[model samples]
Target: MATKEPSFEEQLAQLQQIVNQLEQGNTPLEEALEQFQTGIKLAKSLQNKLTSAEKTLGHLIDDAGNERVYENNTDDPSNNGGGNRGFGSGDSVKG
Candidate 1:
């Protein structure tokens, strides 16, 4: 049987574990490369999920009566939508 895709949280947890393993620097070069590739894929998936959520939610309201629209500035270098931030980035989901 085919394995089910992991949930976002599970994927993020796995990505975090991969990051920790990669950071250890003890893995063989070949294995490290594979892990790095997996990290890249996971990062992309997480980013896409966030982008979708932003589109679905429309906008957000801050605690101080501030309304903010979800805008994705892909051109912004500071936008950690990709590998910019360490693995495991997304909005929290409660089951």
Candidate 2:
């Protein structure tokens, strides 16, 4: 389910849960650092999600008084021992 699309609210809630645990849980230095790194990742993810939403909403306004929408079709390769990331179209996999 890692690749499944998550809503903005869901992502924010999950990130808060992670932060709260890190603040309350007692752990060794190494584990704490690892959690900190994870927190950074979650922060980036939340930022990206919010940015995308903002962009989508602003797509209705343009310099020429026209409205347009942008679609992200980032190519993602399938997980068949290939060299692609496999997150979008133009990719195939073999079982």
Candidate 3:
């Protein structure tokens, strides 16, 4: 049987643990270097996963199986020219 892959949260926790260990300043030079390298790889992987998730969330899928980019309607004139729409405002997409 193949080994199971670690989830994103698990990887993140591992990276945090590595950081804590390095911060303690007790590990030997060679071991510390190895841990640092591993931490870097984990950071990059986490970043890539976050970026991919963001891209996925930035789009909307219609019932017609068409994909559309999610856009903020901050330019709507009904707001009386006030563009102070807070976060998550203008989430509705007009057809």
Best by lDDT: 3
Candidate ranking (lDDT, best to worst): 3, 1, 2
Per-residue accuracy of model 3 over 8-90 as CA lDDT, tens digit each: 99999999999999999999999999999999999999988986776677679999999997754343646533355665575
**Which structure is stronger by TM-score: 1 or 3?**
3
What overall lDDT goes with each candidate model? 0.79, 0.67, 0.83
Which digits, one per residue and each the tens of the lDDT, describe model 1 over residues 11-77? Answer: 8999999999999999999999999999999999998897687555756889998878655435444
lDDT, candidate 2, equals 0.67
lDDT of 3: 0.83
Candidate 3 deviant stretches above 4 angstroms: 72-95
Best by TM-score: 3
Residue 82's C-alpha lDDT in candidate 1?
34
RMSD of each: 13.0, 12.7, 9.2
Clashes of 1: 0
Task: Give each model a TM-score.
Answer: 0.60, 0.51, 0.71
